[model samples]
Target: MPAVLGIEVKLDPKWSIVSTPLFEAYWFTDGLNSGRRDELYSVDVGLRYSFASNLSLTNTVLYEGRTSNVAIRHYRDLRIGPRLDFAF
Candidate 1:
């Protein structure tokens, strides 16, 4: 059986600031695979600033981690990026 759970909250919409939290897990139900499990956790935070009606800049930061008995290795990662939107 597999299950996923998460939560998200937006502090403000005018400034475009948001916070999201999530968790996911999977379990093997079969006899042989019983008790075997995998899990993932992640959080995403983002913000946007409008320079003008037609132009805006946005940034996002993501943090994630994964662990599983089925995989040889477990890993965690952090990613940050910026985006620009414009209309002509």
Candidate 2:
């Protein structure tokens, strides 16, 4: 069980920051809370970069379960490489 919270702040006309609580709950689709498979709904933060009207990129960071944190199975901390998109 988890409680969620959030806030919005406007720094300028072209910039702003929004925050919200994130959590993950794993259960089974076989039945009511079967507790079989696990899923992640990690907490994350992202930055928006606006290089032009037609081009922009969003950078995000997140906290994920570590490999050492797993007691019953193997795991690793969530990580992202990089993302880039071009518009023409």
Candidate 3:
């Protein structure tokens, strides 16, 4: 079996500040029997700066998590970075 679910919310499109949340899950045939299920959840809140019509910059911080069978090990990660996009 396979399953995935997620949602993103933009606090405001016109504003420079925005927040997005995401979630996901995975289930295999052996999930119940072998406990091999996996889950991922994350949130990214950022600011958008537009230099021109097609050039922009996004700076964000992300908090994420990964959960699985103990044998597979579980961990959490945090990230922060800037994303630049240019369209011409």
Query: Alpha-carbon error at 48 in model 2, in Å?
Result: 1.4
Could you say which candidate leads in TM-score?
3
lDDT of 2 by residue, 2-63 (tens): 44565446566444454455555454657643556554445556554556655656565656
The ten-residue window of minimal lDDT in model 2 covers: 65-74
- For model 3 the TM-score comes to 0.67
Residue by residue across 1-88, what tens digits does model 1's lDDT show?
Answer: 3344434343454356655677888787889778778888888787877677688676889898989996754789999998797978
**TM-score list, all predictions:** 0.58, 0.45, 0.67
Off by over 4 Å in 1: 1-13, 30-35, 49-58, 71-73, 83-88
**Candidate 1, after superposition: displacement of residue 18 in Å?**
0.8
Worst lDDT window (10 residues) for model 1?
1-10
lDDT of 1: 0.74
Per-candidate clash tally: 0, 1, 0
